[model samples]
Target chain A: MVEIQNTPPHADAEFHHHHAHATTSRHEHGHHLLQVSHLSVGFRMYDIDAPFLSAEQRTVNVIDDLSISVHEGEIVAVVGASGSGKTLLADCIMGLFEPNAEVRGEIWFDGEPMDAMDLAAARGHGISLVPQGVSHLNPLMRVGRQVDGFGYSRAEQTERTARRDKLFSRYGLAPEVAQLYPHELSGGMARRVLLCTALMDDPKLIIADEPTPGLDLDLAVAALDDFRSFADEGGGVLLITHDIELALRVADRVAVFKDGTVVEETAVANFASPDLLEHPFSRALWHALPEHGFSANDQDHPIPIQSTAFEQGGSSDGGDATC
Target chain B: MLEALSITFGYAKGDKPLYEDYSLEVAPGERVALVAPSGRGKTTLCRLLAGYERPWSGEVLCDGSPLPSSGTCPVQLIGQHPELAVDPRLRMEKTLAEAGDVSDELLAALGIRQEWMRRYPHELSGGELQRFCIARAVTCRPHYLIADEVSTMLDALTQAQIWHFLLNWQAESGAGLVLVSHSPALVERVATRKVLIG
Candidate 1:
């Protein structure tokens, strides 16, 4: 169950000032963005001790003791088979994990520990996470208000507002969408809006979990570009997803998770070669790329990233076959 | 038969229609892939076919019978986002059961054993949830199953497995399959025929 709560502060003045200072050092190279060490999370099962009834619960370890670092301006993708607990790992990073579940991890941002950080503190200090879907945004708020609602520091308001418009232009979303609720916007537009919201905060690190799941190839690429641009602007990104093809395209380095553990971590450039994905299962995953897109050409061929306005010889009209 | 006659649609009170004068037909046992670039109303069309949303103009006829304009229709729509398909609180068994009957035999065939029934949606992996969603849709025995980008989030191996499972189920159940995908590469592999929508 999701234990969503509104709790008061666990830290005050000095901590806030510390995080505030860290937030200002956005372009400082000496500041390490995120350092996660010895992270472990497990769930409790009541049925574990019970011998009666059909109900059997076991202490399931969703994310085992793990540690990985994501530096500023780099895109690190977590890739794994389905059921590998990739999303669970992401939930921990975003501080949304269930309270009952035990999470033992040290998350440090610019040398400051985040173990005691609350959601408000995290949000206020420039950590923005884009959850899995367009629905992740508030459905009731107009898209524009939501983008403007990143709750930036009083000093950064003007800069954030200016950044907001830049993001809209980069993503090719119509200016009119600022007034529409998330439900009213098209699927792609909603995704762009969420991206804009994340960008508006100007966070040093952005963790996006499967941000472009069902979008078409062109739109998916555009969405990836949106994140890449964020990273290019000196923000680190921890992207958790299951699409290896996508990881290869957008990730600088990729981590492979299996059964709640990161079994392998390497650069995307090494993913295609035989030595890169060494595990039998990962090799099998690589071999399984459906033949159509890459059969005539090698998988290494640069994927064509079409801008939103470009004509791909496909229909712009809503009908007459363009799937 | 799954037929839409001149369907026109957009958001409520919206003047700019996303799609206007759109029509399509899928015969029984036909595996038709609706291909379109993003933002071309693929999901809107899927919602129309599944009767989750109403069309501003025109009609969606399933098996030559008119579908309800608004409200839950008999059609089952499996969206591209697996994360949204299953409720967080419900156990896998309860979730699958809500979709419809799940025979012990069907569960095993889909590789979801009895043990998996006790786990919550959050406990399952992306691939596991994807398979579960497919199983749930098939269990409903819908006349027409609309799978929108069902494999988009999956890795290559997992996606291949999903395609195989869907193909085998379609063969056995003989339900009309309306698959909407952005990958032309994927369509060529699974679809018997393709409908391109822009």
Candidate 2:
């Protein structure tokens, strides 16, 4: 039998939102590996509430004026609450725009205007993205073929096969894993397979979105270490995740994303102490860590972030990132 | 009380048993954290407790009896991937209704907005989908709740919010909670007891 303690858990917790926004000015310096300026994405949707004959359409701004950069040989983590149009940012960079979407922004890759150089040609060639869900792996295809991409000629198939094997070995996957399907692999194996896919083409910049979700602590840390190794070898990484502690573990710099925009970008060194950080949002995140009382609100003031530990946040979940 | 009586199970016939004669017990108001690394059958154990899978031997009992084969089960399980729990074709309202009648107060506490009722699972974020899953699980009025890394994908603030709500719900309902988490800090903060599994 268990002891029954019916005391209301954290009854004193009542949240109220009143936070000051902080802004910083950034100038484009020389040339970085990847730089996005004033990037915004809005989807055009039919107004269901509007009269049918009129058929009014409205632009739902998912991301607005989002500016972030990833330099060669450095890992830049874009930390944000989940569901705030974070993945759309990744989609924009990859040129995977939704139908009826209006886009406005400046994206430069290797100092060249991304538009002038077809981003499609650049994607999977110079830039690779480890999508959030391992389910991105085609369920119908074999693991090796998916990692190797499509091959029409015999020689091309052979070359890609060699490359896939090399990547698999590097990631500690067995030779037989190539024959398996997505469902056949365990969670850790599936994640490693995702990493192998990202590394197949020797891409310079890798964008990993929420790659560590189902992984255990050791595997999660090892995944970050893999990114660290990639950076040490002159590659750049844009790791998008909601876990601040995990991001702080390996990222050299951090870009704090809120409401489809990056509110703060600071060095990881500043995270040792919350006082060194500039934005109030960043401080709120510091207070929300599992090790830090798992509470929300900074000094009884709430600004979109609410935790049951004190008051209610506008949303819930470390889930802010799960979005 | 919830009991796993000397359970033995495996995925395939030829393979060595994943769980052999493993037994455990949990009582109402007890928040038990099951600690183990990934691929260690933590998820399998949760599935067994919730009757998503059947054990090859032994049994899972609730209050000295087997779990109800139909109707609302006494054990409610919320897995890590909310995207998997929801049906892509169904609207949120329909899915929530499947669990029975969910009160507005419960929906409000979960931060589930009215506008979301008409939206399909794919239209909502993973967090929002998870909130729906939580609401659905609670609607069953379970005697025990098993959460398997439910908040692993969320941020710290969102994670805190989820655990806080879960703890409060447990207190109010006097239901047992079984949790699996990678974050030790979270486990320390929420669990009333720790049960290690390998």
What DockQ values do the models have? 0.23, 0.44
lDDT of 2 by residue, A93-211 (tens): 88877677688988988677887247878898889998765578989888888888885598988988898899888888999999999889887778778888989888988998888
Runs in model 1 deviating more than 4 A are A1-35, A48-59, A94-97, A105-127, A133-193, A199-201, A292-323, B5-23, B50-76, B81-101, B118-130, B140-144, B173-175
Model 1 agreement with the true structure over A6-90: per-residue lDDT tens digits: 3232221112211211111232444456766667877654453356676565445556767666656668888765555566666
Per lDDT, the best of the predicted structures is: 2
Q: Poorest 10 consecutive residues of model 2 chain B by lDDT? A: B119-128
Total clashing residue pairs per candidate? 11, 17
- Per-residue CA lDDT of candidate 1, range B82-179, in tens? 76789888988888877668777666655564555777665555556667887888877877889888877666665766676778788887888999
Question: Which parts of model 2 have CA positions greater than 4 angstroms off?
Answer: A1-30, A51-53, A132-134, A139-141, A151-169, A173-189, A298-323
Candidate with the greatest DockQ versus the true structure: 2
Best by TM-score: 2
Computed on C-alpha atoms, the DockQ of candidate 1 is 0.23
